[model samples]
Target chain A: MERLPAFELKRPTSLAQAIEWLAATPEARAIAGGTDLVPNLRDGIGAPPVLVDLSRVPGFDAYEIRTAGARIGAGVTLARLASDAGVAAALPAVSAAAASIAGPGHRSVATVGGNLCVDTRCVYYNQSEWWRKSNGYCLKHLGDTCHVAPTGTRCHAAYQGDLAPALIACGASVELAGPRGTRTIALEDLYRDDGLAHLALEPGELVVAVAVPAQPRGAMSAYRKARARGAIDFPLAGVAVRLAVDDGRIAAIDVALTGTNSRPFRLAGTAAWVGRAVDDGLLAELGKAVQKQVSPMRTTVTQSNWRRQVASVEAQRLVRDLAKVAS
Target chain B: MAKRVLSFVVNGRLREEAVGDSTLLLDLLREQLGLTGTKRGCDGGECGACTVIVDGRPQLSCLTLAARCDGAHVETVEALAAGGRMSALQAAFHEKLGTQCGFCTPGMIMAAEALLRGNPAPDEATIREALGGNLCRCTGYVKIIEAVQAAAAAGGGR
Candidate 1:
């Protein structure tokens, strides 16, 4: 069994204490649920000199439904998000995406904040340190050349986060607390589109909470994910579609695709293709345009070409399902 | 490493202990409390081999930190056997041939216990979805699903 490397662990009872500890120990890393970090540490992927356990942090494990929007704490587990009736009713796309992540056990331990802050993954990058050393470290870890794309100048690691696309589609924003006071940013602003430097979060900053806007009236949303298996596998290509209908016509549409690129890609152009059109042909054309817009690199579990094809199919399925439910 | 003190009720008994920060609930049950029925198969949450009921919900002990269960109530597979006899679900498992190697039996039972606690009567689809996380290379899940349905029909371990 792989064991965590030697390190000091500190449990803080409040978010203030956690921030103080993080500021005090420059070598420390904050751990909320440890669903993502613990495995990385045990596998010798990345180990900090100190771990600041955030499980004891008060006010960080709750979900609050305000009149304007819903606020989910950083420590809120996936299971909590999946089972929250208010969240399910208000943000069905987010709830459905959470329910589709891993299994019950994993959902119980994995936190929404952790899932959002999860490291970029690729077939060659997620391997153990020893395995990487034996196979020569790729661009993501040690070496310079990306194994997936040899001619590429930078790392081409894929981001497989399940909730980001849905959250983005729902027009959610995230709060971050660091050495500098707190700041709120649009969820889409957190990603940099670069595989190597995927997130815009600073080194010592912690994601405090996420706020999801309430669904508009006459709006319908759905998430479709394609994976190797029905359960427990990361999405090969997933689509989250949110549609606002006006007098039985599409008023506005928001479409985002995951596991198809380094970060979540918004199919805004494809949304324009299906605007005000409630027919099957328009929906089919929108799906094909979405597939064309998503340039899935060859780093995921599925073949690049196949994943791209499924992205198109899944997008079409999502639109069709939403139209069916709307009508 | 600093050790944290954890206080919780386990199977109708209150227990307290000082454990390491990284001590998993599965280790606390098997090593400290001597409740060995909760087997540990995969330390990761992928396998349901270390499932236990925490605060009325089924959770993977291997993925749960011991300190996280403070002030929570936990029920293990051993708690199901009362008066030195098997519960109805256990009996159904035996009658329906739910176990082949028996390595995954304890976790499966605990998961089923949580399922029945939430929903006294679950259909075949619900049963399968509840036990989807629990993998059984043996039995092919047919007998296990049948056993759960039979237990549900019998009012869930009554």
Candidate 2:
């Protein structure tokens, strides 16, 4: 294991205390679950001088089901989210996606907020600093041109998170707290369309919680993932679909795709294509439309063309399976 | 660098230690507490060799911060035996030839323990899914699955 460089760690017991510390120390970073931060630090990805450990902060780990939806604290581990009976029954797609993340160990330590705010990843950019420097530092870090798409001026790092796509499909919202105070926003607005500036979160802002709407009755959801390996591998392409049916007709549909772009791409037009009743042909057309919507660059574990193809196939399969249940 | 004082129970013993901020539970268990039963295969959480029971649930020690485990109860594979009597699952693994090279043994045992604690008798698919995170380069998981089945059949009462 690579040794982590020297840094100070502070454990705050309250949100106000944590905010005060962050406000005082400009270089300090808040760490709820270190599943993402520690690995990056050891890899020389990013090293802040001080780490504000938020695990001990009171009330930060509580998850509640309200009249509107479920409020998941930032410190709630992925394992808890996946295994919780309430979360599973209420939001099965989110739970299914959580269950399919890296592995049990990672799921036990990785938090929902961390996964949602995870750094945009690419085969070229997720490497050690030395490795990227040796390769002349692609557009994600220092250099000008995007190695993944040499002709394009933008970076093509994909948001390979399993939960974010599912959460977005469920119409979730998030709460953010920082030195400037707290604010709530739609989860869709948190991510930018560009890979270079993937998230719109400002410096010193910490994601506090995510609120997911209650699962409507007769709503069926599923997440399909394709990866090189069955266990402990990131998705080459993944699809999350949530459909609400009433009297054998589709009431609402949300389709979100991941591992194909910097941010989770919502197939709005494609979702609209399968409005009321979906047949095999309609599902196929929707898949084709989703394939056209996703512009995956050659930065994933699989080839870019293969990722796009798999995305189309998986999206079609997920929607078809969901429609079958609805029928 | 600042050090944090952590107090916790490990293997039926209460202990206190001062550790660095970045010290992972894997490092603390092996380097500081001298419990090497938890192996470190992939420090990146891909490999579950460092699995340990934290607050009654199996967690990857490699990814968990030692500080995060303060005030919690940790059970390692070392505590599985009672008065040198091996656990039924451990004996079943030995009888079934479930382990080879022994790198993934501790983690596999802990995972099995957690599985049995929650589900005393699991089907083939359930056992496979529970042990999916743990990688075994040798013995091909056939015997491991069989051993778990045998233990469950034997009532897994212990």
Q: Which candidate is the best by TM-score?
A: 2
- Model 1 C-alpha lDDT per residue in residues A1-327, reported as the tens digit of each score: 365566767778877788888888787888876766766676677667778888888888888986588999988999889888877777888889999888776777688888888777788877677887787888887787888889979787877888999998888899999877899999988887778888898767889999887777777787889888785767888889888777677877888888888888677674565347668887777767877877778786679999888989888888778877887
lDDT of 2 by residue, A121-173 (tens): 88888777788889898887777878888998888888888888898888888
- Where is model 1 chain B poorest over a 10-residue stretch in terms of lDDT? B40-49
Off by over 4 Å in 2: A142-145, A215-217, A274-276, B155-158
Backbone clashes for every candidate come to 0, 0
TM-score, per-candidate, Cα-based: 0.92, 0.93
Model 2, B1-158: lDDT tens per residue?
66878999999899999988778889999998899999999776667899998988878888777877889999999998888888888888888998889899899889888889889999998888788889999989999999999888887725
Clashing pairs in 1: none
Residue pairs whose backbone atoms clash in candidate 2:
none
lDDT of each: 0.82, 0.83
- Interface RMSD for each of the candidates: 2.1, 1.7
- For each of the candidates, what fraction of the native contacts does it recover? 0.28, 0.51
